[model samples]
Target chain A: MTQKDKSILMIGCFDTKEENFNFLRQCIVSHGESVIAMNTGIFGSTSLFPVELESDLVAAEAGESIGDLRKRADRGHAVEIMGKGAGKLVSRLLTERKIKAVIGMGGGGGTYISLAAMEPLPIGFPKLCISTLASKDVTRQVGMKDILLMPSVVDVAGLNRISRLIMRNAAAALTGMAKVNLKTDEKSLGTIAISMFGNTTACVNECTKLLEAKGYEVMAFHANGLGGNAMETLIREDCFVGILDITTTELA
Target chain B: MTQKDKSILMIGCFDTKEENFNFLRQCIVSHGESVIAMNTGIFGSTSLFPVELESDLVAAEAGESIGDLRKRADRGHAVEIMGKGAGKLVSRLLTERKIKAVIGMGGGGGTYISLAAMEPLPIGFPKLCISTLASKDVTRQVGMKDILLMPSVVDVAGLNRISRLIMRNAAAALTGMAKVNLKTDEKSLGTIAISMFGNTTACVNECTKLLEAKGYEVMAFHANGLGGNAMETLIREDCFVGILDITTTELA
Candidate 1:
């Protein structure tokens, strides 16, 4: 896609970390890419863009807000409701092709909300997260996607030397990725998709080899949910010609 | 845990269906107040002893049979490695606490090496599966802890009607949930663990008010990986005084 078509979508609880968001937004603009920062904070605060969409805009579009939908006594309900709103907003941007790449930074709550937004994007659409929980097992957070996780060495409590360094590097990374042309020839090879589990490896391998020798390229995926989902995604993209699902074990 | 303390663990490869494993063993035996079954099949088959201990000797293990593992390989060093040998075998099982629960089942591959060996057990352990992909989504397969998914429905290909029905029901409903009686004088309110997705209404309202009135307790799970892990299996074991978690978002 052209640079103009490659819009970088920056999302997170920017109200809590306006300084870092500002820095990242500047980097995106400087790299010759446009940005749409989706602010997921519950209460409004100053934003880099006056026209930035807030959670209320998301709720309004969805026809609900955290307070309106959640019980006053339950904070978790509010967070979950807000996360839904954010996910909807992000999903819209992705569907409309307004966002070619997405980046977010946050702690536990914000990470939860941001990931909710990122999860709906197609695989390999350039998803990145700079989070305090990056060092931990993020399989749950990143799921089966190609989301890049950058460890925020310091707590995201506020802007600091560490925050600046991390955000700058993240911004640079996404900017470069967004600017690059990743178009591959669509007619190079007809692909076959296969699913296998640890128990059924031998069967799939034998089948894959047989297929390869016949001049068919076989793409194998683990039968785990993400693995299956990834293969389906590629299939949906029309990247594969046929499917020899030998090890369809994990789907069970 | 020590090796002696370690038990023979069984996991299901419910990628296809669950008949063969569930019916292999029958009759539930009591080890103290808990009931245990030997077979891992969930819907089609019925087991005499539903729970098995790690110490007891059993015949088959999920990822053990080399012949079966070979059949499912696709390509790459990782695929070959995962298909054969026991690379992440121990850790993967340990992460799920298989030695602690030892639940498994499948078909040709499912029965050839998946559930037979899991037969011999000391007592007071977990083992279950209801393959046929076990009727769609399988949060139940993982349950609260130490369970494996076995693929038996589609390709494992063999079995009668009774076997399939028994296996499905067994996998979905069987808990292997050991009931332990404790003597306690101290009484605390109960806690509810709620799972929330961005889309539910009833969960958000009922959970909040209930927790406040009873002052019993409330914990909200985000319906993502961590949230599901925290609420469903971990916190449910009385980790907290009480639970009121109603919002379940990511089950789909």
Candidate 2:
């Protein structure tokens, strides 16, 4: 088995989600995985938990000072600068092969900013958002990325019965996704890629069975924006030996 | 005496600072001044206190669906749209005469977003930010508005001994600022306005003493960007009977 660093990149408005995030951090740490806290909140210095990448540093990454930012007192500018900074920081971390996954927590503004930060990461990297807006159509937040939106059934305000359960489960999901390893051997059939959606699921299922029976490996991609983007990205890397297009809804 | 509503507009990223905000709310409420919670956190809903303005509504006011904004997952855009929305919302509230004062708390993004919301309020509206960046120069955050910033000496993470004290004091400050009955009558001398900074403080102070001796109500305005802007704004409204131009650094 190859060595995989279970280092998770956790980002949030530490200026806001301190308690919830602290719980998540503790849960993750107890499970034997290290977490890197990238704070997006620049309110003050009395952070509830220790942060490796403070908002000021993130602001600096975007070519601004936290003091100047406070002076500018522009919310939209803060979001943009932090987003750009997070992207740059995330990109650098990816290049250095430091983080195995990404997870964020926030309501609307926090969700948007953190997810925007995650937008630049390569596909198949585990990305998750425990949001109050998760049950709602999150296509706007997920976009074309493989970001997993877990609905936080309760408000992420104070520590409560439901919030603790939801947060612990989320922490587990990220760690599990990051730690799981599925090794492929050389003797397996060459991989064949297929696109499918609910409307054409039966046809795609039949095609997959037929391909597998013919001694070829098959993998199905959903026709949603995120799935289509994933398929295209994987295809660019020659991750498939052949392609069978079953649904064109993502294009049309 | 003119009637001024004691309804204070309290805005912040409640997603994390629930305990602190709740404490402030209770303090404000107990003091008999109604506090309006203008929520800046768009995360989940387990808010410890009630908010009059939700971030989703703020986003909608910015001309974007919350769902679409979530999908776009753009932080900077979130900040801009929210800022614009807060500006409009605050302006409407001011027009309707709904709020008497503004109070905000958060680290970076929260402070910026909240201050941006306070930008449209006129001079002497009593704007404040309980911020982490308080010790640093906040000319940018305060802008030209009459916004007062109280430093959150601790991180506004949770209700520790220190955080509790700062937040309570901040709450009291807002309530006090809002409820003060500073009834001015017609017998006072004509108001004299002067602008000055450290380089001209001694000169301005000396002049103020002389003016007080001469029976004029002398008010000195610091020549910082915000102060200069405020001086200009107040001057525009015929606030000064006589202008003593002590410093022109804002113009420079």
Candidate 3:
């Protein structure tokens, strides 16, 4: 699917990452792509850019009011509140097929909010996070999602040369990943998803050859966590007609 | 309180990260700390170093056999199987106080296995992962746990200068962290936990001054996710007599 068909949802804490988000949006837009900005910043009501979904709207989506959040005003609580709001908003966008990819950039607070929003998207939807916490242990920020995190060499404090280079590269790469079209053969063949590994390589190869000979398509899943998770996601989407389970070791 | 009182639990896929783990073990040992090595590798039956807990034992802990896994031979499946096994083993060790820190070093498979083991650890226990995927998106590898990840700049294919430097730094840091003994004043003052943020800084400062005047020890939780989670954990462990939740933002 082309990115032109779907807008990239850029989520960030506008209060903290206003400059980063603006630069990132410009980068994405420069690549012939459109953007939908969400203000996930907890401390502010207004943003430098036109934020379509304000933090207050996001908070309301999470069953809270930004006004109430400000009244409370604890950084940790703000993160939780804004994170929930943004997450709910992103989930709704995913369901409505309005977004092809989600790009989030932030410091600790921004990273927490952005990643939380993108964590619920299924595989194949491009999810990218450019953050200060990119190099830190983000096991909780990513969970089991295919969220791609590009480490910002420096802190997301100012628009330094290093930060700009990293952010630019990440934006281009993600936009390319989101929009790239894979050429498909016009011929229709019933596709099959086959799970394989090095030990079972020969067996899978022979099966694939035999399947191809009979006008059937074969897709191999390496059985790694990413491969396994992706295969399941594709299967759930009804993208594959049959499955040849050669190795079920992960089940062990 | 002392490295002599606790041993770091070192877990890795011996088949993939045998050399790295062995080196890591040596570094920690050089710092006068001991290591409990668990081979979480799936491909091999033995390791380059003496592995205290074998992959067979780990698999069995997850209700499977390494022999069966070898015959089936799926790398992805092996990772999942060993991850579960290692996770179970590590959890038990943590509960039994057999380990003060869990150190895992590996490439993709090894990192996966090691991180899976360390994920179940609570807040206070020091958890570290030295991995090739350290710079990559490690959100899944770290989860919500307090695991620290050190990026091995180069691949863990050999004992190169870069890898050695990183491994050494990570080892020394973790050891120092583990062995640090904060000098006690021996003064009996009841401790209080205060959750604060920039917005509540003035209020918290006043409160801290008043509490200290009343001869109460006050510790402030900045109300970031880490700080808030830590405060909750310390509270759960009965580490505080009173809690001043001035900023309730995280509750949103």
Candidate 4:
């Protein structure tokens, strides 16, 4: 038996942006990659292309039915349930190691659902969102995840000149990320983190040299706002065995 | 009695980054603007300059004593309390109409506190944050606010070649925003919201012309993810009389 090919998980509301998704699917296919299209649209599914995961199945994952959601006629509630459903489904696919990357495009609700779906995925996983809200304050949707947001300069309404160019670029980026092989050195001393600012650079550099000389690998993070946040997240992920918090100014 | 001059709000942990804040204050002063510095630092206050609102005062706003916080020695808990305290204090200052703009610079904790302080400010108000985490995911901190984040490429430690340049630019930007008077045209017949995409541009253009001919002001928002989200926000702020959701693709 042969191993199944890892697929790019494409998520969106197929009911509305069917034309745009179809073009995106073609772009992915042109790169010789398989796509697992998932429809999160509550109203209806698309007939333009085949969807591996349908809206009904996605809603079912959230313990709801499409009919019930439609009957409720609440867009906000529907968005929440659909987002939860897609998240669970994507999580399962990740656990099965069936997906190499995830890509989604949409306006407000689509962006929300896509972010929610990608939220559970591990760090460094290829997660891309082609969204209109890319340039906006997406602090709530992104929430510390390394989710790459591509601004849809125009709306993701149809495959016009602008949409075509952006969607193609987005497809290429995602495909490249999915195909790249990251090399890691297995033999290393336990990883140590050292925080540094311009003021503490000299001290951090000296520490790094001494640590390396003793066969201990040292990773330095800038004591900037983002650097401190990143280091904290990595620490929570157990990426470092020891931490030398040299510049703790971020604790202000 | 004369009315008090509107001052730009400067927020940071003065105990540590006192030098940086002092430089920024001087920069603002050079622009002929007054600054209201608020210290969120829990350890101690700065002797470099007068801070109108001190760390102790900020902590007290959160119903905690600076001495008790120091005794706890809990960094995360302190960040939360200090952020809340600064937020309340800033909110009161805003309500009192004492500030023209708000600006802050920091790494992690500073970024959090600064953002929390500016979160309650009105939309369209000038809010600037020079942060190390500017390039990182700050969704939780920024939320839906229009906070302009400037990247402190280097750690915001002391005055260095990099820090000086970036900090100076940030100061200039904030001062410029603070001094600028935005003009509003008050002679509009009621504002109407219209959603549009590339595919529906022609239709929307025609509709907009017809609406304008009927003496109604038409505002078209691209039906992309961000556009939809922004439109929803504006709608909630009562900026529109009616909405023509032509392209609802974001609901995907």
Candidate 5:
């Protein structure tokens, strides 16, 4: 494989579900890309590339049991903190440049944990998640980044026919996206960012039209919680010239 | 006080709590504001403001049953739709430009519904909510808009000491925000928007430095879910020239 074959980083709880992990690994390798799988579950087998950072380690790493963590009654907060730690570890790995894409599979908790890990990546970096709750309102989970959610028709407990099909499609999607070289031209016309909601459609529409008429390119994001975050992410990347925040509905 | 001074738009469930309704009405009038309160609950109030746009009226207008609309499983989704209907009615009042600000009091469902109504107003509009759940995580309720949240310290069951204090502060905040004559200046410098999260702090910092050094003004919004949405609102208003969204963390 040439240097053009991108390295895809797959992060998830790979320990208990060996079939899914192996299937995803085989798929990534088959596509002629490098795979660096990070296992975040406390009970999972030793990760292929084990997270060495002390902060990335879960409470179980300090010999505390899951039951002990639960007894604190702030289990969700504890999990979130740990997810942030793991995210830092993932961020360090992403800075290395070899990891071009990221994909994860999980239920609700795992989805949260994986997203926390992927949140540090820049816009246009491929990110995907296959989860049972993908069909539901994942506005909170998927926020604003370019993370694609693939609904796992079957629970990711074991690799069955349904799981295999969903995982395969997700893998294919990531592989395709990873292979495609996104053209990032600095010389293009500057971009303008805009936010809109269903209620303020008229105002934003008029504003966007007026701006575009003036030779500015307008990128309107739904001012849902995540849409807002996505626009902000692009702003940090120097992607837009000015913002027209018409519908602050979500914020209100 | 003149009738113009008493023009206030009051929103809440006035069905079960007649005393609360009377209390809010008295509060509105005492502060030299006219009350145009809309009753969202099932029961009618003989003493307080009449239901200008009844829920059944809204249902008839939309060609849907009030019962069917109320049957939505997610209370949040239900409130969102109701808020839309309320927003339409309020917009008409706002057309007269008499509604200097909006003040609301409620629980989780009420706050959600009220925000939906208040969200369509442009930024700098005076919006206040006195909510029992205000002290909790209100990111979802307030989103990116600048809605002031005053914790009802006491449950909004009746007008008690704590309730009085909370409501007074809310009223005062809205009145002050609305009454202030804010000077507006046309933004001359090109605006740049950026999203930041703790994990991607380095990227945003470097990018912001780069943009500001190039003679652009930078507006950095935390890429938490709502911060992203707020930035989008500004974008739709034609506020920013470019966006550098490095900390696209919340999108995951």
Candidate 6:
């Protein structure tokens, strides 16, 4: 891949799921997209493909050496440190705008690291995680992020009939999202955030109609724990011009 | 409420949400359902209505006194202790068949305690959490439990136009679920668990069709994190007679 070409950031434990990631990379390439591979596997490296960012650097980012981590031989602790490292590194990559999107495939450890790596990306950044744990509750890991979790449908061990199809689809989806033009007119009077629930839906609808008529864009967030958290986070980031906290139930 | 009537277990911080809970209690009563209220509020008790289980008893369940917890003044610690107590108490109630369903409404602390308290309940058991955090990612707290989280479009502080409508709906829904007669035929060729993903949908569908034709019940689980965990959990409970595991991608 040339330096001038915008790339998809593919992160995973190359030491284990090398074949699956390779297949995913090929699928993306077949769709005329480039990939920047980052390894989060703590044990070792893979010979299948060239990795732009290795596990050593990831470990280093967590303020630990790969040798020390291996010497400790504590899987849980190691995974945690690696996840922190991956998150830090991914954040830097994001800040530099070196990648247009991010994708990862993993089982338990891999999924944890992949999610941690994508934590720094903003909402609608086209982050995808194809994992065995996809069907499991990942609310904590996903938080309020707009990360898309896809069920691998089978173990991402090797390229099989089922694995191949899923990986290809995941690749296609990522490439399509990365290449899409997301330009929208910022000509509205202002953006408003509204808290709403089923009971207040009618009220919110009326308010929204009037606000839109006045040339403002309105976003409604469910007063559920996650929805309220997201809205608050966005509001803190100064994304809203005004607030219509109709259903402040979350505060209770 | 009559002793002969199976009651809905209502859990919340009664000291804070007395009005809301009382309103909810009335709604349930209006629906011909009895409610057993349990308080998890640390500071004080409510005199508005009868509380079947008080915060002192809940705190005692965790091997601590409410006075000591109050003196400590650590909100997080108190919440954690109360949650554990509530969970233990709820588990005991379930074992004794004292309640048919569980419902709670709260903000952050209340939601946390309610979720923790309902942790010991089994899946298919009616459990509802009307919380501000409902819209938030609560996977970690919910784990593999089948808890229905309803977003409190407004805060649970007091009765308002939106809060009243939402709370009433919550109460009605809880009562309806508690009174539901869930009966299914246990007779079948056997139960089979199948893991599937979008890529392997066709194959799984064909297998399921053939299995039904053979008088066997086929259950499919998505290979995502949550889905895979739920399937494995149910399988461990000996809910299945055989396994298809077509899309075992979650294992990856």
Highest lDDT against the true fold, candidate: 4
Clashes per candidate (backbone, < 3 Å) = 100, 28, 9, 10, 52, 37
How many Å off is the CA of A153 in candidate 2?
A: 2.8
- For model 3, give the interface RMSD: 14.8
- The order by descending TM-score is 4, 6, 1, 3, 5, 2
* Candidate 6 residue spans exceeding 4 A from truth: A1-4, A181-190, A198-210, B1-252
The local lDDT score (0 to 100) that residue B185 gets in candidate 5 is 19
Candidate 2 ranges beyond 4 A from true positions: A1-6, A63-65, A120-124, A182-216, A220-230, A236-238, A241-252, B1-252
Local lDDT at A78 for model 3: 83
Local error of candidate 3 at residue B190 (angstroms): 51
Q: What are the clashing pairs of model 4?
A: A107-B224, A107-B225, A108-B225, A132-B226, A133-B226, A139-B139, A225-B107, A225-B108, A226-B132, A226-B133
Q: Higher lDDT: candidate 2 or 6?
A: 6
State the lDDT of candidate 5 residue by residue for A1-252, as single tens digits. 333644677777655555677787776676677787666664435444433333235444434554554556564765575566667766666655557778888877778877787777654456767665553455555554445555453456655333454565466556655654242112222767778778888987898779879977676676756567656666776666677877787778
Question: For candidate 5, what is the DockQ?
Answer: 0.01
Per-residue lDDT of candidate 3, residues B38-111 (tens digit):
98877774446677888889999999998899899888998899999999998787666677667888778888
Residues A165-184, candidate 6, lDDT per residue (tens digit)? 45655665566456541311
Worst 10 residues of 6 chain B by lDDT: B180-189
Candidate 1 on B210-237: residue-level lDDT in tens? 6669754454555656556635444434
Best by TM-score: 4
Off by over 4 Å in 1: A61-63, A66-73, A181-190, A197-199, A213-215, A223-241, A248-252, B1-252
State candidate 2's DockQ. Answer: 0.01
lDDT of each: 0.49, 0.67, 0.69, 0.76, 0.61, 0.74
User: Could you tell me the lDDT of residue A191 within candidate 1?
Assistant: 67
True contacts kept of each: 0.00, 0.00, 0.03, 0.02, 0.00, 0.02
TM-score of each: 0.46, 0.42, 0.46, 0.51, 0.43, 0.51
- DockQ for every model comes to 0.02, 0.01, 0.03, 0.03, 0.01, 0.03
Tens digits of lDDT, candidate 2, B60-131: 888876677668877777666777788788888877767777778877777778878987765445555777
